[model samples]
Target: MTVRTRLLDPAVARAMSAVSAAAKKGLGDPALAELVVIRASQLNHCAFCLDMHLGIARGHGVDERRLDLLAAWEEAEEVFDERERAALALTEAVTVLTDGFVPDDVYDRAAAHFDATRLAHLIGLIVAINNWNRVMVGRRIPPGGYTP
Candidate 1:
Protein backbone atom coordinates (compact mmCIF):
# COMPACT_ATOMS: atom_id res chain seq x y z
CA MET A 1 0.00 0.00 0.00
CA THR A 2 1.18 3.52 -0.82
CA VAL A 3 1.95 5.62 2.23
CA ARG A 4 0.19 8.94 2.38
CA THR A 5 2.23 12.10 2.57
CA ARG A 6 2.65 13.37 6.10
CA LEU A 7 0.32 16.28 6.71
CA LEU A 8 1.24 16.90 10.33
CA ASP A 9 3.87 19.55 11.00
CA PRO A 10 7.35 18.29 11.87
CA ALA A 11 7.33 20.25 15.11
CA VAL A 12 4.02 18.70 16.13
CA ALA A 13 5.40 15.23 15.49
CA ARG A 14 8.46 16.08 17.55
CA ALA A 15 6.26 17.33 20.38
CA MET A 16 4.23 14.15 20.29
CA SER A 17 7.39 12.09 20.41
CA ALA A 18 8.56 14.07 23.42
CA VAL A 19 5.23 13.54 25.14
CA SER A 20 5.51 9.80 24.60
CA ALA A 21 9.08 9.71 25.89
CA ALA A 22 8.22 11.74 28.97
CA ALA A 23 5.19 9.69 29.80
CA LYS A 24 7.05 6.42 29.47
CA LYS A 25 9.87 7.74 31.59
CA GLY A 26 7.51 9.15 34.18
CA LEU A 27 5.69 5.86 34.55
CA GLY A 28 8.95 4.45 35.97
CA ASP A 29 8.40 0.78 35.27
CA PRO A 30 10.01 -0.03 31.96
CA ALA A 31 8.57 -3.50 31.53
CA LEU A 32 5.02 -2.59 32.56
CA ALA A 33 5.12 0.67 30.62
CA GLU A 34 6.26 -1.01 27.42
CA LEU A 35 3.46 -3.54 27.66
CA VAL A 36 0.95 -0.77 28.25
CA VAL A 37 1.94 1.05 25.06
CA ILE A 38 2.19 -2.20 23.11
CA ARG A 39 -1.30 -3.22 24.19
CA ALA A 40 -2.64 0.20 23.27
CA SER A 41 -1.09 -0.13 19.79
CA GLN A 42 -2.55 -3.60 19.41
CA LEU A 43 -6.04 -2.37 20.23
CA ASN A 44 -5.62 0.56 17.83
CA HIS A 45 -4.18 -1.69 15.12
CA CYS A 46 -1.10 0.45 14.59
CA ALA A 47 1.47 -1.67 12.83
CA PHE A 48 4.26 0.89 13.02
CA CYS A 49 3.88 1.19 16.77
CA LEU A 50 3.69 -2.57 17.16
CA ASP A 51 6.96 -2.88 15.25
CA MET A 52 8.68 -0.27 17.39
CA HIS A 53 7.30 -1.22 20.81
CA LEU A 54 7.43 -4.98 20.36
CA GLY A 55 11.15 -4.71 19.73
CA ILE A 56 11.60 -2.38 22.69
CA ALA A 57 9.61 -4.64 24.99
CA ARG A 58 11.58 -7.70 23.95
CA GLY A 59 14.82 -5.80 24.41
CA HIS A 60 13.73 -5.09 27.97
CA GLY A 61 13.20 -8.82 28.52
CA VAL A 62 9.40 -8.90 28.49
CA ASP A 63 8.21 -12.46 28.09
CA GLU A 64 7.38 -13.72 24.61
CA ARG A 65 4.24 -15.39 25.98
CA ARG A 66 3.06 -12.14 27.50
CA LEU A 67 3.50 -10.34 24.19
CA ASP A 68 1.75 -13.11 22.28
CA LEU A 69 -1.13 -13.22 24.76
CA LEU A 70 -1.52 -9.44 25.00
CA ALA A 71 -4.48 -9.26 22.71
CA ALA A 72 -6.21 -11.90 24.77
CA TRP A 73 -4.96 -10.73 28.10
CA GLU A 74 -8.22 -11.32 29.91
CA GLU A 75 -8.25 -14.90 28.78
CA ALA A 76 -4.62 -15.46 29.75
CA GLU A 77 -4.90 -14.79 33.47
CA GLU A 78 -2.10 -17.24 34.16
CA VAL A 79 0.38 -15.16 32.17
CA PHE A 80 -0.31 -11.59 33.31
CA ASP A 81 -0.14 -10.54 36.94
CA GLU A 82 -2.94 -8.59 38.63
CA ARG A 83 -1.05 -5.34 38.15
CA GLU A 84 -0.50 -6.00 34.48
CA ARG A 85 -4.11 -7.00 33.94
CA ALA A 86 -5.19 -3.75 35.50
CA ALA A 87 -2.88 -1.74 33.25
CA LEU A 88 -3.97 -3.66 30.18
CA ALA A 89 -7.59 -3.12 31.10
CA LEU A 90 -6.97 0.58 31.52
CA THR A 91 -5.14 0.65 28.20
CA GLU A 92 -8.08 -0.85 26.36
CA ALA A 93 -10.60 1.33 28.09
CA VAL A 94 -8.64 4.45 27.20
CA THR A 95 -7.74 3.31 23.69
CA VAL A 96 -11.28 2.41 22.58
CA LEU A 97 -13.47 4.71 24.69
CA THR A 98 -16.35 2.82 23.11
CA ASP A 99 -18.91 4.59 25.21
CA GLY A 100 -17.05 7.85 24.97
CA PHE A 101 -15.79 7.30 28.50
CA VAL A 102 -13.52 5.15 30.61
CA PRO A 103 -15.41 2.83 32.91
CA ASP A 104 -15.02 3.46 36.61
CA ASP A 105 -14.14 -0.14 37.34
CA VAL A 106 -11.23 -0.05 34.95
CA TYR A 107 -9.94 3.23 36.37
CA ASP A 108 -10.37 2.03 39.92
CA ARG A 109 -8.54 -1.18 39.24
CA ALA A 110 -5.64 0.74 37.79
CA ALA A 111 -5.67 3.15 40.70
CA ALA A 112 -5.50 0.26 43.13
CA HIS A 113 -2.39 -1.05 41.44
CA PHE A 114 -0.63 2.29 40.85
CA ASP A 115 -0.27 5.33 43.06
CA ALA A 116 -1.77 8.68 41.99
CA THR A 117 1.37 10.01 40.31
CA ARG A 118 2.04 6.84 38.36
CA LEU A 119 -1.66 6.65 37.48
CA ALA A 120 -1.42 10.07 35.90
CA HIS A 121 1.65 9.07 33.95
CA LEU A 122 -0.07 5.87 32.91
CA ILE A 123 -2.98 7.85 31.53
CA GLY A 124 -0.58 10.13 29.73
CA LEU A 125 1.17 7.13 28.19
CA ILE A 126 -2.14 5.63 27.07
CA VAL A 127 -3.30 8.89 25.54
CA ALA A 128 -0.03 9.38 23.70
CA ILE A 129 -0.05 5.90 22.20
CA ASN A 130 -3.65 6.21 21.04
CA ASN A 131 -2.92 9.49 19.29
CA TRP A 132 0.26 8.11 17.75
CA ASN A 133 -1.62 5.05 16.55
CA ARG A 134 -4.23 7.17 14.79
CA VAL A 135 -1.62 9.40 13.15
CA MET A 136 0.51 6.52 11.86
CA VAL A 137 -2.51 4.54 10.65
CA GLY A 138 -3.91 7.61 8.89
CA ARG A 139 -0.64 8.09 7.08
CA ARG A 140 -0.52 4.38 6.18
CA ILE A 141 2.98 4.21 7.62
CA PRO A 142 4.11 0.61 7.45
CA PRO A 143 5.57 -1.43 10.32
CA GLY A 144 9.24 -1.16 9.36
CA GLY A 145 9.09 2.64 9.18
CA TYR A 146 10.01 2.94 12.88
CA THR A 147 13.79 3.59 13.09
CA PRO A 148 14.21 3.32 16.89
Candidate 2:
Protein backbone atom coordinates (compact mmCIF):
# COMPACT_ATOMS: atom_id res chain seq x y z
CA MET A 1 0.00 0.00 0.00
CA THR A 2 2.59 2.49 -0.96
CA VAL A 3 1.28 5.99 -1.20
CA ARG A 4 0.07 6.76 -4.70
CA THR A 5 -2.03 9.47 -6.22
CA ARG A 6 -5.64 8.40 -5.86
CA LEU A 7 -7.66 8.79 -9.02
CA LEU A 8 -10.87 9.52 -7.15
CA ASP A 9 -10.58 12.29 -4.65
CA PRO A 10 -13.57 14.18 -3.36
CA ALA A 11 -13.67 16.30 -6.49
CA VAL A 12 -12.56 13.75 -9.12
CA ALA A 13 -14.69 11.02 -7.60
CA ARG A 14 -17.80 12.60 -9.06
CA ALA A 15 -16.51 12.39 -12.58
CA MET A 16 -15.39 8.80 -12.03
CA SER A 17 -18.79 7.98 -10.59
CA ALA A 18 -20.45 9.20 -13.73
CA VAL A 19 -18.25 6.97 -15.80
CA SER A 20 -18.96 4.03 -13.52
CA ALA A 21 -22.70 4.60 -13.69
CA ALA A 22 -22.62 4.65 -17.47
CA ALA A 23 -20.47 1.54 -17.59
CA LYS A 24 -22.86 -0.23 -15.29
CA LYS A 25 -25.80 0.58 -17.52
CA GLY A 26 -23.86 -0.45 -20.61
CA LEU A 27 -22.23 -3.62 -19.33
CA GLY A 28 -24.79 -6.40 -19.25
CA ASP A 29 -22.97 -8.78 -16.92
CA PRO A 30 -21.09 -7.56 -13.90
CA ALA A 31 -18.94 -10.65 -14.10
CA LEU A 32 -17.86 -9.98 -17.67
CA ALA A 33 -17.00 -6.41 -16.83
CA GLU A 34 -14.90 -7.52 -13.91
CA LEU A 35 -13.12 -10.11 -15.98
CA VAL A 36 -12.23 -7.64 -18.68
CA VAL A 37 -11.05 -5.19 -16.09
CA ILE A 38 -8.85 -7.76 -14.42
CA ARG A 39 -7.35 -8.90 -17.69
CA ALA A 40 -6.62 -5.40 -18.81
CA SER A 41 -5.14 -4.56 -15.45
CA GLN A 42 -2.90 -7.56 -15.64
CA LEU A 43 -1.69 -6.54 -19.07
CA ASN A 44 -0.93 -3.07 -17.82
CA HIS A 45 0.82 -4.41 -14.69
CA CYS A 46 -1.47 -2.43 -12.47
CA ALA A 47 -1.51 -4.22 -9.15
CA PHE A 48 -4.09 -1.97 -7.57
CA CYS A 49 -6.59 -2.61 -10.34
CA LEU A 50 -5.79 -6.33 -10.49
CA ASP A 51 -6.59 -6.76 -6.82
CA MET A 52 -9.76 -4.70 -6.95
CA HIS A 53 -11.16 -6.36 -10.05
CA LEU A 54 -10.27 -9.86 -8.82
CA GLY A 55 -12.25 -9.29 -5.67
CA ILE A 56 -15.13 -7.88 -7.65
CA ALA A 57 -15.08 -10.78 -10.09
CA ARG A 58 -15.06 -13.38 -7.32
CA GLY A 59 -17.85 -11.61 -5.53
CA HIS A 60 -19.86 -11.92 -8.74
CA GLY A 61 -19.35 -15.74 -8.77
CA VAL A 62 -16.29 -16.14 -10.93
CA ASP A 63 -14.43 -19.18 -9.60
CA GLU A 64 -10.80 -19.98 -9.01
CA ARG A 65 -10.37 -22.09 -12.14
CA ARG A 66 -11.38 -19.43 -14.57
CA LEU A 67 -9.35 -16.85 -12.70
CA ASP A 68 -6.29 -19.06 -12.74
CA LEU A 69 -6.49 -19.69 -16.45
CA LEU A 70 -7.28 -16.13 -17.43
CA ALA A 71 -3.68 -15.24 -18.19
CA ALA A 72 -3.37 -18.29 -20.40
CA TRP A 73 -6.96 -18.29 -21.51
CA GLU A 74 -6.35 -19.58 -24.98
CA GLU A 75 -4.44 -22.66 -23.84
CA ALA A 76 -6.86 -23.65 -21.14
CA GLU A 77 -10.09 -25.63 -21.22
CA GLU A 78 -12.07 -23.51 -18.86
CA VAL A 79 -15.59 -22.17 -18.68
CA PHE A 80 -15.19 -19.28 -21.09
CA ASP A 81 -16.83 -19.71 -24.50
CA GLU A 82 -16.27 -18.10 -27.87
CA ARG A 83 -18.14 -14.96 -26.92
CA GLU A 84 -16.15 -14.44 -23.78
CA ARG A 85 -12.94 -15.06 -25.68
CA ALA A 86 -13.87 -12.50 -28.27
CA ALA A 87 -14.68 -9.96 -25.59
CA LEU A 88 -11.38 -10.74 -23.90
CA ALA A 89 -9.60 -10.14 -27.17
CA LEU A 90 -11.38 -6.87 -27.49
CA THR A 91 -10.27 -5.96 -24.01
CA GLU A 92 -6.67 -6.61 -24.97
CA ALA A 93 -6.90 -4.62 -28.14
CA VAL A 94 -8.57 -1.72 -26.43
CA THR A 95 -6.12 -1.63 -23.56
CA VAL A 96 -3.08 -1.93 -25.75
CA LEU A 97 -4.48 0.60 -28.21
CA THR A 98 -1.89 -0.59 -30.64
CA ASP A 99 -1.93 -2.40 -33.96
CA GLY A 100 -4.04 0.38 -35.50
CA PHE A 101 -7.27 0.32 -33.53
CA VAL A 102 -9.27 -2.84 -33.03
CA PRO A 103 -8.86 -4.99 -36.10
CA ASP A 104 -11.85 -5.82 -38.30
CA ASP A 105 -11.51 -9.54 -37.66
CA VAL A 106 -11.62 -9.03 -33.91
CA TYR A 107 -14.67 -6.80 -34.19
CA ASP A 108 -16.37 -9.35 -36.41
CA ARG A 109 -15.69 -12.12 -33.93
CA ALA A 110 -17.03 -10.06 -31.06
CA ALA A 111 -19.99 -8.95 -33.17
CA ALA A 112 -20.96 -12.54 -33.80
CA HIS A 113 -21.59 -12.91 -30.10
CA PHE A 114 -22.85 -9.51 -28.93
CA ASP A 115 -25.58 -7.32 -30.36
CA ALA A 116 -24.87 -3.71 -31.30
CA THR A 117 -25.88 -2.33 -27.92
CA ARG A 118 -23.87 -4.83 -25.92
CA LEU A 119 -20.92 -4.30 -28.20
CA ALA A 120 -21.03 -0.60 -27.54
CA HIS A 121 -21.28 -1.21 -23.85
CA LEU A 122 -18.43 -3.67 -23.91
CA ILE A 123 -16.24 -1.15 -25.68
CA GLY A 124 -17.07 1.43 -23.08
CA LEU A 125 -16.08 -0.91 -20.29
CA ILE A 126 -12.81 -1.71 -22.00
CA VAL A 127 -11.96 1.93 -22.38
CA ALA A 128 -12.82 2.75 -18.80
CA ILE A 129 -10.79 -0.07 -17.33
CA ASN A 130 -7.86 0.69 -19.58
CA ASN A 131 -7.97 4.32 -18.53
CA TRP A 132 -7.91 3.28 -14.90
CA ASN A 133 -5.00 0.95 -15.52
CA ARG A 134 -2.99 3.65 -17.25
CA VAL A 135 -3.53 6.16 -14.49
CA MET A 136 -2.76 3.75 -11.64
CA VAL A 137 0.31 2.36 -13.34
CA GLY A 138 1.54 5.74 -14.39
CA ARG A 139 1.21 6.92 -10.82
CA ARG A 140 3.34 3.98 -9.62
CA ILE A 141 0.77 2.37 -7.41
CA PRO A 142 2.31 -0.40 -5.36
CA PRO A 143 0.89 -3.92 -4.85
CA GLY A 144 0.50 -6.58 -2.11
CA GLY A 145 -1.48 -4.37 0.25
CA TYR A 146 -4.86 -4.85 -1.42
CA THR A 147 -7.14 -7.53 0.04
CA PRO A 148 -8.10 -9.35 -3.13
Candidate 3:
Protein backbone atom coordinates (compact mmCIF):
# COMPACT_ATOMS: atom_id res chain seq x y z
CA MET A 1 0.00 0.00 0.00
CA THR A 2 1.13 3.55 -0.75
CA VAL A 3 1.88 5.51 2.42
CA ARG A 4 1.91 9.20 3.13
CA THR A 5 4.02 8.61 6.18
CA ARG A 6 6.66 5.90 6.44
CA LEU A 7 4.36 4.38 9.03
CA LEU A 8 2.65 5.36 12.22
CA ASP A 9 5.11 5.04 15.10
CA PRO A 10 4.70 1.60 16.65
CA ALA A 11 4.04 3.08 20.07
CA VAL A 12 1.50 5.53 18.70
CA ALA A 13 -0.33 2.76 16.91
CA ARG A 14 -0.47 0.70 20.08
CA ALA A 15 -1.70 3.67 22.06
CA MET A 16 -4.48 4.30 19.59
CA SER A 17 -5.52 0.67 19.72
CA ALA A 18 -5.49 0.83 23.48
CA VAL A 19 -7.78 3.84 23.43
CA SER A 20 -10.13 1.96 21.15
CA ALA A 21 -10.06 -1.04 23.46
CA ALA A 22 -10.77 1.07 26.51
CA ALA A 23 -13.67 2.79 24.82
CA LYS A 24 -15.15 -0.51 23.72
CA LYS A 25 -14.77 -1.95 27.18
CA GLY A 26 -16.42 1.02 28.81
CA LEU A 27 -19.21 1.14 26.28
CA GLY A 28 -20.23 -2.35 27.54
CA ASP A 29 -22.22 -3.53 24.56
CA PRO A 30 -19.95 -5.41 22.23
CA ALA A 31 -22.43 -5.46 19.37
CA LEU A 32 -23.30 -1.81 19.75
CA ALA A 33 -19.68 -0.84 19.87
CA GLU A 34 -19.06 -2.71 16.66
CA LEU A 35 -22.05 -1.01 15.09
CA VAL A 36 -20.76 2.43 16.00
CA VAL A 37 -17.31 1.75 14.63
CA ILE A 38 -18.71 0.16 11.51
CA ARG A 39 -20.89 3.19 10.87
CA ALA A 40 -17.98 5.57 11.29
CA SER A 41 -15.82 3.39 9.04
CA GLN A 42 -18.56 3.41 6.45
CA LEU A 43 -18.78 7.19 6.48
CA ASN A 44 -15.02 7.52 6.37
CA HIS A 45 -14.79 4.95 3.58
CA CYS A 46 -12.18 3.00 5.44
CA ALA A 47 -12.27 -0.28 3.58
CA PHE A 48 -9.67 -1.84 5.84
CA CYS A 49 -11.77 -1.00 8.91
CA LEU A 50 -14.94 -2.18 7.24
CA ASP A 51 -13.37 -5.49 6.34
CA MET A 52 -12.01 -5.98 9.81
CA HIS A 53 -14.98 -4.73 11.82
CA LEU A 54 -17.60 -6.47 9.71
CA GLY A 55 -16.07 -9.78 10.59
CA ILE A 56 -15.93 -8.77 14.23
CA ALA A 57 -19.54 -7.62 14.16
CA ARG A 58 -20.63 -10.94 12.72
CA GLY A 59 -18.69 -12.69 15.43
CA HIS A 60 -20.57 -10.62 17.99
CA GLY A 61 -23.82 -11.93 16.47
CA VAL A 62 -24.93 -8.75 14.78
CA ASP A 63 -27.43 -9.61 12.11
CA GLU A 64 -26.47 -9.53 8.47
CA ARG A 65 -29.53 -7.40 7.74
CA ARG A 66 -28.38 -4.79 10.23
CA LEU A 67 -24.97 -4.62 8.62
CA ASP A 68 -26.49 -4.47 5.17
CA LEU A 69 -28.92 -1.74 6.17
CA LEU A 70 -26.54 0.32 8.29
CA ALA A 71 -25.90 2.98 5.67
CA ALA A 72 -29.59 3.55 5.56
CA TRP A 73 -30.26 3.03 9.24
CA GLU A 74 -32.27 6.17 9.52
CA GLU A 75 -34.67 4.81 6.98
CA ALA A 76 -34.49 1.25 8.21
CA GLU A 77 -36.26 1.99 11.48
CA GLU A 78 -37.51 -1.54 11.67
CA VAL A 79 -34.01 -2.93 11.61
CA PHE A 80 -32.26 -0.51 13.98
CA ASP A 81 -33.61 0.27 17.45
CA GLU A 82 -33.81 3.70 19.01
CA ARG A 83 -30.56 3.25 20.90
CA GLU A 84 -28.79 1.98 17.80
CA ARG A 85 -30.22 4.85 15.81
CA ALA A 86 -29.04 7.33 18.39
CA ALA A 87 -25.55 5.90 18.30
CA LEU A 88 -25.49 5.78 14.52
CA ALA A 89 -26.72 9.35 14.29
CA LEU A 90 -24.01 10.46 16.66
CA THR A 91 -21.44 8.55 14.65
CA GLU A 92 -22.51 10.31 11.46
CA ALA A 93 -22.53 13.70 13.11
CA VAL A 94 -19.07 13.20 14.53
CA THR A 95 -17.61 11.53 11.45
CA VAL A 96 -18.94 13.86 8.74
CA LEU A 97 -18.27 17.17 10.52
CA THR A 98 -19.86 18.99 7.61
CA ASP A 99 -21.96 20.87 10.10
CA GLY A 100 -18.94 22.03 12.11
CA PHE A 101 -19.90 20.29 15.39
CA VAL A 102 -22.08 17.46 16.41
CA PRO A 103 -25.52 19.06 16.60
CA ASP A 104 -27.15 19.37 20.01
CA ASP A 105 -30.12 17.31 18.90
CA VAL A 106 -27.99 14.36 17.97
CA TYR A 107 -25.91 14.60 21.09
CA ASP A 108 -28.97 15.01 23.25
CA ARG A 109 -30.63 12.06 21.63
CA ALA A 110 -27.66 9.90 22.35
CA ALA A 111 -27.44 11.23 25.86
CA ALA A 112 -31.03 10.33 26.47
CA HIS A 113 -30.25 6.73 25.67
CA PHE A 114 -26.82 6.30 27.25
CA ASP A 115 -25.72 7.24 30.74
CA ALA A 116 -22.88 9.73 31.22
CA THR A 117 -20.13 7.12 31.33
CA ARG A 118 -21.49 5.20 28.38
CA LEU A 119 -22.01 8.41 26.43
CA ALA A 120 -18.42 9.35 27.05
CA HIS A 121 -17.27 5.92 25.96
CA LEU A 122 -19.50 6.14 22.92
CA ILE A 123 -17.90 9.41 21.95
CA GLY A 124 -14.52 7.95 22.66
CA LEU A 125 -15.31 5.03 20.39
CA ILE A 126 -16.36 7.39 17.61
CA VAL A 127 -13.21 9.43 17.95
CA ALA A 128 -11.04 6.35 17.99
CA ILE A 129 -12.67 4.88 14.89
CA ASN A 130 -12.45 8.18 13.08
CA ASN A 131 -8.77 8.40 13.88
CA TRP A 132 -8.21 4.85 12.72
CA ASN A 133 -10.20 5.57 9.56
CA ARG A 134 -8.00 8.55 8.73
CA VAL A 135 -4.81 6.62 9.31
CA MET A 136 -5.87 3.69 7.14
CA VAL A 137 -7.39 5.86 4.45
CA GLY A 138 -4.47 8.27 4.44
CA ARG A 139 -2.07 5.38 4.01
CA ARG A 140 -4.23 3.84 1.26
CA ILE A 141 -4.35 0.56 3.12
CA PRO A 142 -6.23 -2.18 1.35
CA PRO A 143 -8.96 -4.27 2.95
CA GLY A 144 -8.22 -7.83 4.13
CA GLY A 145 -5.06 -9.11 5.83
CA TYR A 146 -6.24 -7.41 9.00
CA THR A 147 -5.43 -9.24 12.22
CA PRO A 148 -7.64 -9.31 15.30
Cα-based lDDT at residue 124, candidate 1: 97
The 10-residue segment with the lowest total lDDT in model 2: 1-10
The C-alpha lDDT values of all candidates are: 0.92, 0.81, 0.94
Write one digit per residue (lDDT tens) for candidate 2, span 19-76. 7658857877888888788889889998888888788889999998899889887777
Is candidate 1 or 2 superior in lDDT?
1
User: Which candidate number would show the highest lDDT if scored against the true structure?
Assistant: 3
- The C-alpha local distance difference test score for the whole of candidate 2 amounts to 0.81
How accurate locally is residue 39 in candidate 1, as Cα lDDT from 0 to 100?
91
Displacement of the residue 91 alpha carbon in candidate 3, Å: 0.4
C-alpha TM-score for every candidate: 0.95, 0.87, 0.96
TM-score of candidate 1 to 2 decimals: 0.95
Task: Write candidate 3's Cα lDDT for 1-148 as tens digits.
Answer: 5656547799989999999999999999999999999999999999989999999999999999999999999999999999999999999999998879999999999999999999999999999999999999988888888777
Colliding pairs, model 1:
none
